[model samples]
Target: MPEETPAGTPEGTSTARVGGTVDVGGLALTRVGFGAMQLERLEGDRDAAVALLRRAVELGVNHVDTAQFYGNGFVNEVIRDAFGDDDGVTVVSKVGATPDPGGRIPLRLAQRPEELRAGVEDNLRSLGLDRIPVVNLRRADSGPGLRAEGDQVVGLDDQLAVMTALRDEGKIGAIGLSAVSLETVRRALPVGVVCVQNSYSLVSRQDEELLRLCVEQGIAWVPFFPLGGSFPGLPKVTDTPEVLEAAKSLDVSPAQIGLAWLLHHTPNTILIPGTADPAHLEANVAVGSLRLDAATLRSLDAVESRTGDIVLD
Candidate 1:
């Protein structure tokens, strides 16, 4: 087993240091959290997936992100079977889609208020939880993946009403927003969003404004798809020349540099990189300790890219 860090109290957002752990959405999560989307591939041998999750917790990872539609609920089954009751992993799940085992894409938008509520119940039933620590309502209003159309275009306030109801009735601990725009986040602020999960990385800086807003509002910015790939001009994080150079200089992998730069760049940023391979899982978790220097940070910061219309603040 790899060395372990204390699961005890930790510091965050202080000027002097950006530690390996962060306090996000009333929960203390490691800066490097685990995303369970890839567990969909391990359905044939669920024990392996369970073992991987156990290993992640063994390596001091307490924050896990999952969704009900991943693997048509197989992922949640593994997550359900992975840990004992005392295992202290904070599970943050996403709603706005349901499992469609036969569809070309595994998930179709569950954007209606009722569908969002049912999504929460489905997650709870499969994960065997009465209350999830945090549940993100994936807006699908902007950015890549799963656009809403026709009647599926539910009003944001209507969705928030049901999510708020869930929180009130103790079905979810806190609310979060996923794949939303800066304006969308601003409009939802009155609902007391605890985190924002968008596609952000050193290579893709389109969401820099949204990220800054999250920091200013004391919201945890837990970025999904850490390697920014959806945009046309942005390079994959590991393929970026500066990131690769920094990785070589630091004696680490380019991916590690990419992940580490995120921690260095934003005090409130939390990462949830996912993988199905045990070795890859370990490496992703190990990024929590990969610290970059001032020179390398400056180099990564100065790396330029086109973000279509977004002007960086």
Candidate 2:
């Protein structure tokens, strides 16, 4: 469990925090943010999860990534229970999928336009809030694995139409995207996408083109698999020799170096590294302070990029 901290943000975290700032729908948030999915894995330990989340906010984390489908709305429940409409953190949730217990991947696509609206409502109900600050339309496109088929194959415009309606109605404050291609993002540009989440890391640079596009378009680049994934045949940044060397030299963990690299690799880049452990949560937020020198950056940049079989969304 994380060591408990007092609830005080803005003046508290911003005063001595190293996590830099980024704009999410005009909200200046810590670039190194927290992802709340690990709380879902702690099914039998709600208090510990809530405590950890509270600690994250106490440590200056104002941007949190979550999903109503995570633990079938249990994650958002944990968020509500932990923060209770706290405005210090920007609660960003995703649509386009729901939990599938005992299924192949534990998640099935919900890509229909109606399903999209229902997903937004599900987030609102779960988080105990009428307005979700930022919602990502997790399109079933550019699948690292999951794909849409039959009636699940909804068009971009169809999904955005409902998302825009929700935004107009104040159901969601802004919009984001995941598991998308450059062309798909280009098409969604008219709707004013605030951010784009994808599977990107030091080892996996396949989305460099998309990252550049986001930089040019002023969209926030929020990468999910910042340290890569645990899927078989997938590459992990911690397992790389260069990252291991950098950590040894800097007296930090390889995972920290991997995350720090992401923050330095591009502008408007935000990271949502999640953990169930107390120490790991603090370490994840501290990545913003880990600096990479020219030599370290060059060595890491020289390493080959590996997309592997990790999920893209």
Candidate 3:
């Protein structure tokens, strides 16, 4: 584990450091971290991308969540070009989705038992890593048009078999579930599910039960879209009155409030808010020190009118 220093905690952010630090599925990471999805959308400025990544590490961000599907494998390339030799950072990547010939992520079950090895290998090749510290089996079928009550948790036996085989072969250190339901998490626990990555926010509380289960079991609950993703035709979570009021009272951005709430809201929850801009990345990491009062947290929690659903399509 890297030693935490004063640089890790910026001045006047809060009395406590950036959500302190914790071990997520044996990978030591700061509670507040960066996501690499946005980096995929960067059209140019490769140097800016590298600088942004290095600055994130300088700000005490060690855990980075990414996937090969993002930008059709270009996101991992950004990570590799930026920190390919830096082992201090723990890079978490996902499997189960791939791009088509036209370079679009289609909705399909691509991570079957026979396909698992290639998925892991592809990630390894893209990120230039010997072994992925953590690999999430993203349930491709967990999105819209699927019945969460039934048939969503199918192929666990086969998926787990391949995951276990890869672990035994020393290709992956841990296995996790992404975009899955609470019942799917329950079914995945006995086979050593170490983390759960779901679309969770103050407005989107669909995964509340799943988050609680992760807390109780000491499993890492990584919430993507901490400020909400840009899903077409869905509501945004950042423009809420409660969040704005809390941001004014706390003298911080609404995005920071959302992140701080997630940090204060749970002990095991780890955030992976992504951005390609260097300044925004710093602001995101600074949320570790942004603290919220009890009343503000309560008010933010009680405002149901602002809450939205998990928009996973």
Candidate 4:
């Protein structure tokens, strides 16, 4: 848990509740939090990364999601530099994977017990947090292992043991799972789950069942890649004709409509739309304020539920 502090936001900044609060390890978090994946040079330009993070907090985002593997500590450093000792913020970071020094994405899984411990330590040193509010174990692959595999590598039980030890030692407040299937989530629930981070959006509803489970269980559902994947030909929820029409009718942007749809679809759903542009960051926060009516929501649901060949995996 973050240290006690004032209630108001930074100077000239404002906050809007995207939805009601949900408790994560006794911490009440806003439904709309910030994803710090864009705070890296993977997509190019560190200046833009810094600007977006600063803009996110300035727009009243308190819950922040990051991972040590994201840019190999660069993203966490960005968060530390932006919000230094602001008790109003909660930083949730993950371990399990290690990024390749020569590239932007992670190389492979190194989630042994010792590696998980080291990852948590590195995250603390990078983010300057003594206790991470939420620590998620990010699995490298989603589906089942090989048929002939013996003594499965990176077992969920093993990972949960490490996380349980960390929580018992007061190193982390809550534990979560990321980039895994609903089966993985169900298996880890015995270890006490607080959140589930998955690649979910209008275009990619592969984890819809898991999302509904989180809603029913009162666990926070943090959706990464909310805009669907990389740009140029990104399969975005905002690009759908139904979403565009709903935005037009509501006099709001398509992005805002997408966020509104997620906010209304489930109370436990938390949209983490990442952007490197400050203007886009402000606009993304404004999404929390847009409310879609029943008619527009039904139209969006109909269009989005139609299965297409645009797979996110």
Best by lDDT: 2
With a 3 Å backbone cut-off (N, CA, C), the pairs that clash in candidate 2 are none
Q: Write the per-residue lDDT of candidate 3 for residues 141-209, one digit (tens) a residue.
A: 344322323333347778888988998889999999888878878987887888888877777677777
Global lDDT of model 1: 0.81
How many residue pairs clash per model? 0, 0, 2, 0
- TM-score for each of the candidates: 0.89, 0.92, 0.87, 0.83
lDDT for each residue of candidate 4 in 109-137, tens digit (9 for 90 to 100): 66677888999999999988899988988
Q: How many collisions between residues are there in candidate 3?
A: 2
Model 3 misplacement above 4 A: 1-17, 84-87, 100-109, 144-154, 305-313
lDDT of the candidates, in the order given:
0.81, 0.84, 0.76, 0.72
Give the lDDT of residue 111 in candidate 3: 58
Order by lDDT, highest first: 2, 1, 3, 4
> Given candidate 2, what's the lDDT at residue 28?
78
Judge candidate 1 at residue 239 and give its lDDT. 80
Error of 3 at 37 (Å): 0.7
